[model samples]
Target: MTTLNHYHYKRLQEFCSSVFVKAGVEKEQADIVAASLVQADLRGVDSHGVVRTAIYLKRVEQKMINPKAKIRIEKEDESTALIDGCNHFGAVVGDKALKLAMKKAKANGVGMVGVKNSNHFGTGAFYALRGLKEDLVTIVMSNASQTMPPTGGIKPFIGTNPLAVGIPCGECEPFLLDMATSVVARGKIIVAAQKGEAIPHGWAIDKNGKSTTNAEEALKGSVLPLGGPKGYGISMFIDIFSGVLTGAGFGKYVNNMYENWKAPQNVGHFFITIDVNKFMDIKTFKHRMDLYIRDIKTEPKAEDVEEIFIPGEMESRRSEQRKKNGINLSQNVQRELTNIGMKYGVSLKDALMLNHNTEGKGV
Candidate 1:
């Protein structure tokens, strides 16, 4: 069991905020990114969350990502637009893009936005929820660096691209689904390697294209897509739309997290926001969605199955618990946080206490 030191977690957030601000991110924007990353840890999406902070700071220092990149609408139509990310951090650009999409959707019946020259965004669900607040169904996808291999080939050729969807249901929480195309995200492999742990089979193959449980070997190899070839096709489709079509980096042309330093990644993303009222009545859609979820969950399971899970249901519940109880992180994460705090000369434990008291909330 990995135990995260609470003091270290709080300190990490402070350190993340300070670095972001030093990089010229506005205070509010820095806070948002920091919160989003921390939220990922709280929700059990360790890969996307705070774990990437050190890497992000490194990119910022290298000037590969603009600390103060300006965001601009390069093109606009009634319900469509294109955003130039100006090489900014993805969390900032994605939020800006989603805001524009929501605004356009409110004005029109639907909205679609494409962005280019962005950095890596944390989680897709963050943007998806933005659309849901407006009673809109949302879709988001992004292309990433090559980490997964093409079907039948050994070397990496495609990224573990992700697709996310969110549907509003009135008073009920939105039905949200966000996932990586790979059987497991690259971060999991990295984490496993860091911990000297063995990954499961079918999750990765070594450089020789043989399945292996060794995380170190998996790092040298490539991950396989879920459902075999079909998943690879889906990931490729995402690359085409979010990368090639947007004129962003694709395949090996993209920046490798392990190597690239100076050049902007020129990443791309797609977002679609559809007003529920534009289709069937919003209530009708909500009730139908509720029924679908309820029925699927209520159905009988095999003897070994303990329970069924809807994609976001467990996540939402876990988030609630963490929000109230504070998030627990692993020892490695705590060590990283401690390092970050020491670098900044700030005590993480002190910061947590300050934050807790400032919010007038008890733990």
Candidate 2:
């Protein structure tokens, strides 16, 4: 097999969902997980995409994730609520939580929800985009197993702790910002290690605490916090909001989804939804947002910069391109997916092989 090949997103999603169902996940939930993973691939964030399916399946096999676990609200107020994920897949928990927030926001202009006992929810932007569907602005954040160290420290304590925001811009697509507090998401390092690729300097250090470009060494060590202490500070608040505040795992207490076979991850997430009409007329808000984005993007470019992209614009473009042209899956990821599919009785060749005439045509 070559180093890379293109696959239709729908085909990939169906393959993933089938594998999940064969492994005993309900059909609806399986679709949710599959869509979330494919959404990552579509947006060029392959780190959170289908490459994660192997680990996700392993967690299921080990009973670390409850495929049919119930998601329920534990407490609530007009504009605030707390929900328990029941150790379900992270995307499932996030979907329900974000929807609940949206429901509340529709009624009260603003809604906030904290989630507990969740598993690794994929990209936060998945939920952010959900908010965009309803013309709402949403913020989504989550804390993962510790992989980044606090500034000036060698030992890992805080998670990369990702944050994402989606802002509706009316006629244009929503403005999206999604990122990890660490210089790079740990999943990217994992992907590099899987592909035998080296990471760039300043991304991480070896377990020995020396900066290293080797992905495996970086995995053994810790990814660097973005901007040093500033990134560390942002991580603290993310943990506070998505973890501590939710009464879920926090600091170093969250179990690792990869290493901890004895228990559920109990990961946590926080979501905030704002309804545009509640604050201003929808027309005015959209017009103002257009002006705001234009003002920032049309400014003078930095040295050698040809264009400036608003937050999430690049990803949105990547998504549209991938939708028209298929997604790329590395050989290593393909092998793993094939192996897992075989275990579940799905034909990898049938699922991945594409007809040339339909290639990159969103088949």
Worst 10 residues of 2 by lDDT: 351-360
lDDT of 2 at 303: 100
Write down the worst ten-residue block by lDDT for model 1.
1-10
Highest TM-score against the true fold, candidate: 2
Task: Give each model's whole-structure lDDT.
Answer: 0.80, 0.89
True-structure Cα RMSD, model 2: 1.8
Instruction: Count clashing residue pairs in model 2.
Output: 0
Cα miss at 90, model 1 (Å)?
0.7
- For candidate 1, the lDDT comes to 0.80
Please report how far candidate 2 places residue 277 from its true position, in Å. 1.5
Model 2 gets an lDDT of 0.89
lDDT tens digits, residue span 1-363, model 1: 112244334445666787677666788888878877876776778888777877887787788888676799999999999899989888888888888888888789888888888988888888887777777899999998888998889999899999989988745556889889999888899988988999998999999999999999999999999788988998999888888877778887777765677577788898889887877888899898888877877899999998788777788887766555566656787677667667756445554433454232334
Write model 2 residue lDDT over 237-284, tens digit each, in one string: 999999999999998989998889998988999999999998898789
RMSD in order of candidates: 2.8, 1.8
After aligning candidate 1 to the native by TM-score, how far in Å is the CA of 360 from where it should be?
A: 15
